[model samples]
Target: MTVKTTLSFTDRHHRFLTDKVGQGVFASQSAAVAAALEQMIRDEEERELTLGAMADEIRARLDTPRADYVPGENAFATARARLQAAREA
Candidate 1:
């Protein structure tokens, strides 16, 4: 089911939508708006997921004992060398 509602856009945004529809990117203004909104939703969800993962990593690192951890300099160099090897492969 779809709900119909009125939305207002600035002149520039309206023109951009109109041009996209005219160029056959979308069949109508509604389609263009829907596509834009869907992409925005996807992007925001991805951002939230990324931030959540980063928080989990930080928490895990903080919980680890200092004795169990490697030095930052050695860890960074090892990671960089691995990445370079992967790219070359």
Candidate 2:
């Protein structure tokens, strides 16, 4: 299903689309625009999936028992000691 509508583009954008069409990169301006839109949709979907995964990870981390986790100060001191050792080596 295709909907016909008028679209406005800057001169630069028009030239880009025209050049792509001339180079056989796309069948027409509409095809180029559709491809761009499809890419945007994919990017948005990927972003949503990444955010959901990050949220799930945060939730899992929050559910961990406090006693089972290292204190932040201890963690930082250990990291600093490792860094100093690496620098000296």
Candidate 3:
């Protein structure tokens, strides 16, 4: 089920879409708009999922005991040394 709606674009945006359609990038203006809207929906969904995962990770970390934590700098130093060794090899 698809909903039909009218959209107004700025002159610049209209020209950009027109040029894209002229170049055979899309079958029609509707196709170009539909493609862009689809991409936007996907991007927003991904952003939401990422934020949810980050929130879950933060909550899990907050529940962990501070005594079990290692200094971040120590981890970074270890990773940096590994990269240097890899480069030398």
Candidate 4:
């Protein structure tokens, strides 16, 4: 399969990519970019999945109220102190 597009690259990056391709590391500049873009897409998909899982966890936390909050202590400081204490223990 073959694809073509008018893609732009900065001078420095262009030189760098071209050099790698010229060294026989890649069959062509397009091949190098396509390989990089394929990896980027895979990474982005993984990131999106991880973020979605985190968002779900956050929503669950929001629905569950903690009974440990002490009066007069700000939420952040209390949470940080509890977490640090747990880590030290």
Whole-model lDDT values for every prediction = 0.95, 0.97, 0.94, 0.88
Instruction: Give the top-scoring candidate (TM-score).
Output: 3
lDDT of 3 by residue, 13-53 (tens): 89999999999999988899999999999999999999999
Clashes of each: 0, 0, 0, 0
Candidate 4, clashing residue pairs? none
- Which pairs of residues collide in candidate 3? none
TM-scores for every candidate against the unseen true structure: 0.79, 0.79, 0.82, 0.64
lDDT per residue (tens digit) for residues 42-63 in model 4? 9999999999999999998787
Residue 34 alpha-carbon offset, candidate 1, angstroms: 0.5
lDDT winner? 2
Q: Residue 51, candidate 3: how far off, in angstroms?
A: 0.2
Residues 1-89, candidate 2: write the lDDT tens digits. 88999999999999999999999999999999999999999999999999999999999999999889987788799779999999999
The total of clashing pairs for model 3 equals: 0
Error of 4 at 19 (Å): 1.1
User: Which stretches of model 1 miss by more than 4 angstroms?
Assistant: 78-89
Candidate 1, overall lDDT? 0.95
